[model samples]
Target: MNITPKWWHDAVVYQIYPRSYCDSNNDGMGDLRGIISKLDYLKTLGVNVIWLSPVYQSPMDDNGYDISDYQDIAPMFGTMADMDELLAEAKQRDIRIIMDLVVNHTSDEHPWFKEARKSKDNPYRDYYIWRQPNEDGGVPDEMGSVFGGTAWEFDEQTGEYFLHIFSKRQPDLNWENPKVQEEVHKMMNWWIDKGIGGFRLDVIDLIGKEIDKKITGNGPRLHTLIQEMNRATFGDKDVLTVGETWDATPEIAKLYSNPARDEFSMVFQFEHISLTWQHGDKWSPIPLDLPALKRVLTKWQVELADEGWNSLFWNNHDLPRIVSKYGCEGEYRVPSAKMLATTLHMMKGTPYVFQGEEIGMTNVAFPSIDDYRDIETLNFYKVRTENGVSPEDQLAAIHVNSRDNARTPMQWDDSANGGFSDAQPWINVNPNYTHINVAQALDDPNSIFYHYQHLIALRKAMPVIVYGSFEPVFEDHPAVFGYVRANDDVRVLVLSNFTRESVTVDLPESLQAEQVECLISNYTAPSTLAQTVTLQPYESFAVVLPA
Candidate 1:
């Protein structure tokens, strides 16, 4: 049975956005108790690991990403006791809990930042990056923040400036300080001692910032910092670690996840995820190029084959839903969702299912800007409009690319507020939740949820799905995305149609008319293998070819 204990290698992870997952107290926000209520449901969905978004004490300025305290649970989410209860309950269900670790920056209100800003001579002053203004008395550098405006925030009381790679409320931490590193490592160990599974380190690669704030990420000391972190925390423990890496090349990624280095188990790279936008501008919306996306995916798969590992995902809290963005969401929603699940799950990596993804829940189109809560969306609207872009154009871009699209409340059933709460949710639920929800999906055997369940089971049962070689097939095909995954004794061929029109896939001459097993398919396959196979719209089929 090849029963090794590396559960993360083939396990399916589910991500939960706390404020939107469920509201047990009817306070219009999801809490730890809310998550506890959904544990049985998540277990039914066939996921072994749950990656919860930040529930730490925060000022709610970036939706909990701006943390004022790393060890305490935000009062809005629940109490520290609530978090412990959640961990105990999840462990009983055989599911591991992964917490979000946002160490790159802390909310301006954090005690460390407050103490550091008291005066340059304070013991905590070196904990954060602070620079004196230039000769012109302007900010240290003209570097732009991830949200908008300059990355340097002027401190009037201190007569200097502090760097914030994201929102001004989030000041970047100075990793060069040994005290800072020791504190972070101590906090990580505290969580491990609490019986928590592991962590999802947010924007971890950006910690190694260079001297000039303008040049961000993948700095000179990135690897050293990561290795030091591993040695101090998760290296000897049975814990899972995945770093959120932005703009990281394959070469840089290998260093983070290579087992020999003892850094991380994998990394979440954005190359394939950013194919729909211009490299530097999120406001420039464009159609996704399938060929380009294929090239990026193939590159990562091949490059990380012998070393490191890949964290596969199509949707998360930061991006729009995959179905509405990359697949047809109206008429072919179910088929397209199933097809995407097959393609991602069949690859040699851990698959993540964002909440509502299994039920084919889609993106929302809020009528106006006032309906949105994401800071990035609102910032883009203001910045682009001031840059001469029309209000209509800016809203159009936000509709297509806003992070809020994925932050809507989970669709539980056809009830007031999608059965998520008795009161209105903090964020609006997609109106389509009436027809697309977990209750409705459970009623129908042929649903996106069941298909996902089957796919997860298939991945768990097949060793080749986790350790086999990956080779792209029909790379030049316009509508069909096909690939071959094989080991010494087994070869699995997967064929998926990306478009809503019929397409044909051609097989290699060596395998024509060979005996095969129909392992999985969204639709019934042809009687036997042949030189050519015609696929229906959104059809996805996988078979084991003869040796």
Candidate 2:
């Protein structure tokens, strides 16, 4: 398959979870104005695009994911004027802003949902999925919510159960309704016209769910709906569209991202992240299998090398911090963080740097459940406790897997609230912020921030980083992740040690070169690549050789 060059192919994205990013007004939440105030900072960080989490009108259920109004900004996040200012300011810095499009569901407080529940014959009834209860007065199906509990919510007024695959407060939108699709498209076009970049669709795969058939993702009409969506908005424009699809395999990804399909620029697949999920249960944690992780990542790299695109990321608002989950958060935090960045950024994908990730933020272990704010975390606690799980075990799992671990406020300085807000924050800031902050990172030449800056610049300078074909090296190595990216001009050999102990590996004769250019390394640069090389704890580097 022939690849078409696009701007985002070489671009790096920075994701900001709005409420915790920066609180400019001391309102205990980050707003559009706060984001605008940091445009220069983001510009300095070298990210080409900013993928802002949901800032639309919401009741704060699910933070901002359960949107109530599609066109208006939430009061907590500021007004439409603030959003316009952010877009304008980011554009000035050559940074494109992509808002999260959460069409999978809407806050139950939304006008459509409110009216839909008023009476069965309401005109807007079809805007959301509704079904009558079974003969036993039970739910429409045996489906469970992603957060917990039943996916169907009973409405007394309408005498029907509305489908909500997430929080009961978030009713799933009916994509089968042409009017809903039109409304979503119209709203997207409104943002595009405002000069916004594109969209990072939220749980987009669930939009075409066949509820009656118990199919939630990769449904029969999933691609058809996405293609129609592309035609309706951002299809002709030079905009990036990435769909959040937990069920996406290489085959399914091709249907969604292959250029000829006109669906999405790429899809965020969870195969790599799901490696630690034991028996598909996130709360049931297991040791990170380094070899298994390499296999999963290599599969995606090789499978999507030609037709589809990839979204490279380790941390997001919905997942635990990378350093905490996959690296050392203690003594080796700096090197491990840089090592993780070097490994992921060198892959062929549009890499995303979550807020605080550039400076090596780790997961927060809040003492009690009362300190947690994420709906998913709270729900899991309640459900598991009721199921006779010990509170101690649950808290241990929460420390490692809770979404709230990533929702902590950004640590800017050592001052109060980590300089995120003057007053108490909506959630507790990580206590380690005193040392792990932007201020300290800026002062240190060997900080993780500088490492990321160099990596981003490297991506922009080397076409091989973006367009090179990937081939796995040391596929059977226990603790080493090795790969080679090659094109006509150069072959870049990237290697990382995913362990706390020093490991040595022999280089293949094919990868050996007479002359090598050290592109980037987390540790001191070696003079040359010897046949047998020893990598220190969490060490990673990339070197260029003749293709």
Candidate 3:
């Protein structure tokens, strides 16, 4: 908590999903050299850390999340030597690399799992969560895996069922076993020895959750396990471990950030991101709770500002693109995307950039449910269909909220395959490349890329954004969320209009200056009058205070 690592606290992390980021070889999948090719682009954007999704040796299940070999890169992604080159190149640019740590589970094909399944008495059997089948020889009851069916999959040879919180190919590790914990540490240290930074622990909250029962929705076990793992793996080594805790409450999330807890540097909670579903169930029709989101984030800010940092993100590889999710999707896409970015990055948290997010990439459409390859999205479709929802309706639901929305190939430019691949890409790139791509965005001064680059640079230069105390300014104002971030004499007021109508932001007479200048904005006007700031529909701006 005592100014741990200044770089990670305010660092900009750009996520590179290995398969879709860029492919140097003509094999049609992205590789490490491909990332090396773009180091200058990342350096130009002012990001200091690159968070790459799983490139470990794996079976194709869940993309690369299902690791079959912890120590090797998937041949499709490149070799160990290639990773070394990537680390060297990134280091030269002052960009540290953080790979995904998927130790919570491994591919069924993983040597550990293979040995475990071969015999119940194998030394590696305890590496996974294994249980006996029910009296009826059926898998034990549970809500089901995030992918589909029971969370348990049967192994005929071992005559036992193994828990798979995710896809069948991904078996959960038994962290309760000290030896398992040791092996995980060994793997983590292996990466550390490779000169890479730490990890963006995948589903780390769920990692701690117990295997005694299937999750009814979300439970407490996730919290406890992550703490134990952090103690074993990080333990004051100045590791940048961020747990992925979806559905974790603000109060519970604080525990991970509590310096006394030995949990993690930060944890990702799902309050702001969930606001988009506004009508989905546990997986669908949910309603947006803007006021609740404001309150939740505020609570975290108040509680953990000094003790821990927050992992602020708007998009990731496993969710719908932010532009179509929270921003005005139909007519006001550009303005709203910029506003949403303003609303998010301006807050008191470390910002994470998903691939192609700066250029306002959008959701890609799958012609049908089968066209969707993501396990969670496909599982949701099957569940809704079995619940008597029509196929058309089910597909309609996935179209809007599926995790597949975020997995499309990165659109680089107007090349034959969006410049991602000369050969066929694993997934189709969003066809909006003509309107949205790095090549075009970089050429235009007013493009989202320009805005994001400025945002990242400002964050690096200003301590107020990184170390300032946050206070929500207009909490009670309708369709408006405003906050003031200040550190000593440096003060900045960030105001955003979340609605489609212009809103008035009232400033206290004492705090209001005679005239204010727009430090940054997406609108045509350079600066508006300070007395009565007129925020256009979905407009946002950063105002440098008169200190």
Q: How accurate locally is residue 187 in candidate 3, as Cα lDDT from 0 to 100? A: 80
For model 3, how does the per-residue alpha-carbon lDDT over 1-547 read when each residue is reduced to its tens digit?
5655555877888999888888888678888999999999999988989999989898888899999998998999999999999999999999999888886788999988889998989999988888887789888666477777778888889899998888989998887788887788878877887788778888876656555654422456655656666666666575577878776676676777777787777878876676655543535545455676677667777777777678888889877787777677657777788888887787777899999888888887777766777877877777778989888877766777777787877888998788988988877777777777889988988888888888888888888888888988777676777888888877788877777788876677745776566667878643434556778888888887777
Local accuracy of candidate 1 as per-residue lDDT tens digits, 1-547: 2323477998899999999999999989999999999999989989999999999999999999999998999998999999999999999999999999999999999999999999989999999999999999998877889999888899988999999999999999999999999999999999999988899999998888885645568888888999999999989998889999988889988888888877999899999888888865767878877777788888898898878888899999999899998888999998999999888899988899999999998989898889999999999889889999998888888888899989999999999999988998898999998999999999998899999998899998998889899999888777888888999989888888988999876788855655678777888864478898888889997888878
**Clash number for each model:** 0, 0, 15
Relative to the true structure, how large is the alpha-carbon lDDT of every model? 0.89, 0.93, 0.79
Query: Stretches of candidate 3 above 4 Å error?
Result: 1-5, 213-232, 278-283, 286-289, 524-529
Please write out the lDDT profile of model 2 over residues 123-171, one tens digit for every residue.
Answer: 9999999999999999978899999999999999879999999999999
Candidate 2 ranges with C-alpha deviation above 4 Å: none
What does candidate 1 score on TM? Answer: 0.98
lDDT against true structure, model 2:
0.93
Q: What local lDDT score does residue 138 receive in model 3, on the 0 to 100 scale?
A: 86
Q: List TM-scores for all candidates, in order.
A: 0.98, 0.99, 0.94
Sort order, TM-score high to low: 2, 1, 3
| Model 1 segments more than 4 A misplaced | 1-5
